[model samples]
Target: MKEAAKGLVPASSSVNEGAAPLVERLIAAATELRIGVERLENGVTVLDGGIAVCGSVAAGIAIGEICMGGLGRVRLTTSGGAGAAEGGWPTWLEVASAQPVLACLASQYAGWSLSASKEEGGGKKFFSLGSGPARALAAREALFDELRYRDHAASGVLVLEVDRMPPPVVVDKVLRDCELAPEQLTLILTPTSSLAGSTQVVARVLEVALHKAHELGFPLADVIDGDARAPLPAPSPDAGVAMGRTNDAILYGGQVHLTVAGGDEAARDLARRLPSSNSRDYGRSFADVFRDYDYDFYRIDPALFAPAEVWVSSLESGRTWHAGGIDMALLRRLWLDEA
Candidate 1:
């Protein structure tokens, strides 16, 4: 698996034209090794016919290594989408199994697997299993194969949705069946509004149970909470939350405050003046700005509220930029006095 690099250069720096030299270097290296390359729109470069080299490198190098050698044709694609595209390598398998009626209902809606097996008391049990997106596709294919074996219609199957996190005992069983480690498992919780109310409730319960299991050292990678239209909560802890503009000013220190007036354009101009030239386009949400503000001195709209102020009495050499708060008095003394 290859991890993408961050902090390569300032986002506003146009000198490089968004192309890193390393990409060409890797391409040359691959060509030297006799690997083929296929290019796609949106910066997707796939190496045809090779095993992916597992290591860390610049984004360009990582793609090149994947094109080098492998059991089957291994392709690497990169996008800014949530979660790793293709669910990252060394894939983890996700399974969803439920009562037959429920499974049949879900299958009708989502085209997941639904099958019936006799239970001890004479009722039927329904189940389905899936991996990440690619594996899910594979699972559907396998289901069709199985359906063909049994001479049954396989249209409109629903993937299984679990309500409560599985108990450790149940999780262990699933791990054994999938032959996957706990770290690979990512429990997905569908919100109550999207699914039938009953199903939604169950999903929430399962999510909580799985969270406890994770806290207890289960190897689960994450428990995804899902709601079709719900806004994501702010990141935990003040330091982690991204700042964003509500109207005139940006919110920070748990309150909306005025850092700059005028409007969004002015706020953005102030943002460009900040030392972190890599900050996202000011038109982007405050959360995005916060993510890039590693050295601080962030710009905000002052009309929202009183600006939080910090004093830097003197400049320190080699300090790069400053954090904490800005000194308004000094700013007025320097800029206003000059005016």
Candidate 2:
């Protein structure tokens, strides 16, 4: 492996090198379950990488949680609830890590929106959010600037929430941007419509909460520990529908408990402003709001992306504030009322 560039510490010296180990764990777990894996001649490892995985039962919950920012541990589980109203869906996934701030905030939410510009072989455009440990390498987004988080690893794993396997052109672009050789990179693909895809997306309850807090201008550094849950919606016939259900699970059924350093007053403000209900466009399925804005995600209210309920504990003051609760009426509406 190349030495760290001048003035930079070796990857060994930095604490940020969590992606490599977690990728190994994810691979082992998936392989034990007979989940599909592939290694291309270019040394790129692909997990659930193609249409062959479509409709195939996969280790969705396990595979999904493993891709988070150097996960401390992940639990892929199902619900105690019975019936279709576990609505929109039944599986629930959760993660707990010692480095909750890094794992949930910097790694999992997948803030990077990678698009092929005309110069990068625009003949056919490709798009996927650059996430997982590789984002620490890419550090392309504005959030990275504020978080002051970055990593340099001999090997890296990245998770892409896209249907198609990344073409070599795209893969090359990522490797170049991350400054890693193909052999050192592992790529996992999960489409929104796939069983595993929806499972993982729903598993992002904690990430959604953190993202919401970040959007509300809450200092994320204050967040100490987080645990969250949302109904795992079933994969739908349409990719768009599956996406909608997973999103609604978070928007209407997801719940979060955040332990933070802030005092009660600050926690109350966060609690009051941090649920999907706080948004003006609160009562609709994500697909509806998305389509109403012509499928332009940016057009939707950013606040609507939060969990349905939030509980904040002020570690500094020993006070806890709970705001919002399951919006089952809205969830049921989104579940059965899908147009």
Candidate 3:
């Protein structure tokens, strides 16, 4: 029953400033709804005393809708560095629709910082870019020219930074006829540690920029971390596993060979039960279906000291199915489309 904080706020007026006010406002808003905010220095905020909503952005939106537009207690986990890199692109485009004329400052200088801000004025949200003075000036001009030719409202600015000179400066100068301000800007800094280590340095700068954007209320839906990559757990020993294309005349190889008999009623039954939508819609006898089917066999490369053979028998014969290495249950699941 708690209400979520509304609106995004700038992270810092200056680089060294803490996010105390932002956190305080968020806490106050949530507290009104009987929710607690747990702030962590590692850039994580936990919402408690309500339903714990945890998942991707899509999941969060669904949860929000279910709560009747209410924001529930949630844990905002970083999805690695995905948010830091590609986040906010859509938001920038959306804002550009309104304020057609805006400057976008991206830094190619070393040791520069970047930030974003959102303000409500004239019944619309105005986003601003903050960065070093040089990048800010250039971004202001570029925005003006973009607005003249475009039909969208001049929303705000997009700041992008790199190790080299940014394109905004040239763009702004080209449209010098229009005057732009230093305040309506977003600054993105791209710094380089060294010419040899440019790539690594650029990557780090990008990550930092993304984090800063998220802190500034850019709604970075998620942040995926690259360092958390890990392998999937092995399957259970008792679980039957088979990997093959669905509803296709195919051959499987392992400790045992399962030769699907063409006309056998049991084979037909098994084929009928194959895990596939096609089988349900277009039921066909296995014999008539795979008339020219050729059985291909392969050995379980490592050789699991077990008896293996291909079972080619007729379904009408009622022959007792015998296979040394075949898991009957798994075969049933695979053919029945129950898996």
Candidate 4:
């Protein structure tokens, strides 16, 4: 019988033993795909952390789990999957008990929001903000300070969602920031266009809502659980097109439900403010905005990065406030354009 690579985390573990750090699980996934790990020189390497470079539906599930920082459970579900197999299965993720703020908002989704870009050694040097628990160890972003959370560990694992691999200098900075040797660091690479990549990106629906809540002064600590769904688009040959379609999944079709304990008014206001549609950059596909900005992410409006709709149910008051709705017309337009 074919089995997962040895030493990988079993599907079952003692709950009393404490959950493993998300980065460790990510590395296990990398080890499972060691043949798919592409080693680069200069003490830096590029590796397939989850599914192989060209991944599978199961791999997409694993990737979604990684995106939740492993605090959340990601699974393939048939919800809204009627005619949904446009080449990929549907997925859902849920999180509770762990640090959702640190796991998803700071460590996972918020890391690469505005990454560093530079040129060194006479060649272009670019580093997407590293994701996963390693970002907590690096504490490289203002979001880390705002959250007062950081991870201290011997190993620094980073997940980068980019079409290009990191150059040596980019690798060096992470090593220094996390105070780890080159050999102690691992980078999991997933481009925005691949099947795994798209699944993982749509997987951020919950994080998007949480981050926006934080931005709106909602007490994120009160958010006890979260789950979300977004349509899975088919893989595309063009990375840009794939990226656009995936963002559309979130901006147009994604729906996030968060359970929290803030007052109904606060929850309502936060929910009211938390959708991509609230941004002035709404109505147009993300591809259109990317093209208008010449593909520079920073140049685009930051407010536009959020789920299409958010539903917040207050645990204390037992009240739910919902805002926004799916943009099916816009979603279909993007899909037909891609087709």
Candidate 5:
């Protein structure tokens, strides 16, 4: 595998640079997108998708694209609902990327952890896992080292799934790590209970697949192209429920297709192990699993965090392999109620 990986070309594009223009366009169309915009005291710009405004589906799709560092496309589409009632969902978020590794792992993965506690002089307890193109500039996570990638850009954009503004301390940390002036930073806040949040989270279907494949020890550089989609559930007002719905959307209803440069055997192995059904905790709704685990997210099986279905095509052998199947019954149970 290491020998084959040498043939892979290094990624030369800057994710932060690629996303800067998209960030400008998103802020430029804030009013039309039905989102709120504000500037903090420190001169850092903030865009609110659901906190102070009623965010729309359009804004979510746009944010999803930005989250992928402009390397991926996100769109709203209708599901065919085959072999199930209403096909479990009428709406879905479809995502595609030619640069799957960089788009999903280097950009979209929420691998950076930021937090503030009252004891540490923070105004209140605050925590969020940072995502989007800005992570490439910070390069704080070890994953960046493994990928041997970093970004150099004058501007940066970050997406946070939180209901409130980040503490100024956390913002300061971002400025220091990315070496960006306050004016050069933009923070986007999307709460899970909002339309925008649900859309953007479900849009991570492809990213989740890439992340799982990486975790399973597959050679990421071999993954050349990818596409995926998952059912979009109504955002719940309850925080826990909202989180579960987003996760369950991928665990039960998401599907992904990956194109790789590896041999047929390697591609078949990746396909076999890249689905949620392979985990012991696969039979229940995510909400139920969370409750059973006493709401401690880490206590649950990490293997359960994958798309329900997958397809892998090996360019080397001109063959394709598939594994897993979507569970529409479980999706309908979680998404719909017969009132």
Candidate 6:
């Protein structure tokens, strides 16, 4: 998609190497972060954020940073005034990245689909969209071909949002594809129904915006910087409910600001087209949409995968364009406990 920009822009850093230390740091603070760390017999390190242990918001924040390949910032903040009251959400995740294209699309986009079925020799079925720095090492997605970026590192980490540990065959696949020894690899699991998992998913607000812009035919190289915020939803016990809340947090309440180097008209058009509201399937909760579609994500509209609102600022024109609006009433109805 960004074939032209591939030749024009060079990757500024190795995502794997940048995030390796962050992974170590997260491990070092695991106890305090309320996460579980285990080493497999073959020496692969596994960090469990929510599957077997109680994972906290702090762990999610650290994992979110690692998912960006250490090129982005993810932190918690709070909103104020009537809007916060109406939305019934006060706490939010504030995300920012100076290297928007690389930090988001190249590392945090969850483009690598990894799976191991029972027929594939794993006793149980396993499937997940792998995210984080390990994706750079694998470079399995065609998106990497368009970006023309690869990472060379002695160690790598992958973050998977799953309830169960990956099968041995799946682990072996990652080791082989990433060209890393068992001892040099780490796998972090964050289930969607857990606190840490929900937080980390909501932290992808800015990355989602960047991805949608690319889908909309915006020049990725032109996007210089980006920042976004989305409410931190209460994790639900039901897997479907949890997934819906995380997605709706961004689709209904998320806001994004992108700094681009382009003409004012281009920026304005991007602003007009970048919100989830523009989708034909926009008004309903994502859970309801997912249910109506028989739980198949591919059947849903791709255009609906965007923030609630957006602002695009043209660096050359010194003017900003804005579009869309947040649906706090819908968010409140879905998220609030009126009892």
Best by lDDT: 6
TM-scores, one per candidate: 0.18, 0.86, 0.17, 0.80, 0.95, 0.95
Report, for every candidate in turn, its global Cα lDDT versus the true structure.
0.24, 0.72, 0.23, 0.64, 0.88, 0.89
Q: In candidate 6, which residue pairs get closer than 3 Å at backbone N, Cα or C atoms, i.e. clash?
A: none
Q: What 10-residue stretch in candidate 1 is worst by lDDT?
A: 223-232
Model 3, 1-339: lDDT tens digits are 001112121112111111123223434555443433443333233333222311122222112111110111212223312211333111100000010001111221122223222222333332222232233223343421422222121112222222222333332431231233333222222121211111212112222222322223332221111111100111111111211211111111111112222335544343222222222212332222333233221222111111122222232343424332222233233334423
Residue 126 lDDT in candidate 1: 39
Measured on C-alpha atoms, candidate 2 has an lDDT of: 0.72
TM-score of model number 3: 0.17
Task: Please report how far candidate 3 places residue 178 from its true position, in Å.
Answer: 10
Worst 10 residues of 3 by lDDT: 92-101
- At residue 125, candidate 6 shows an lDDT of 79
lDDT of 3 at 325: 24
If both were scored by TM-score, which would come out higher, candidate 1 or candidate 5? 5
| Model 2 lDDT per residue over 1-339, tens place | 111112111223222366566557657766454446789998899887334655333466655555565563556456513323444344555555545557766677677777765466446667888667677777778876777767776777788888766667788878898898888888888887887777777778888888878888887667777887776666786988988999998888888888877557778999999988888888878898999999998889888999988889887678888988786667666565456
CA displacement after TM-score superposition, residue 180 of candidate 4 (Å): 1.2
Better of 2 and 4 by lDDT: 2
Q: Mind giving the per-residue lDDT tens digits that candidate 4 earns over 1-339?
A: 012112112223221112235444544565353314655564544556333456554555565565555666666556643224443334433323234564576545636432344655236546565666567667778876666566665565567876666666667777788787777676767776676677667777767777777877776556666777776676677888888888887888777888776567877887888888888888898888999999898888777888887788887788998888877667666675542
In order of listing, the candidates' clash counts read: 31, 1, 32, 0, 1, 0
Better of 1 and 4 by lDDT: 4
lDDT of 6 at 248: 98
Ranking of models by lDDT: 6, 5, 2, 4, 1, 3
Candidate 6 ranges beyond 4 A from true positions: 1-9, 80-82, 85-87
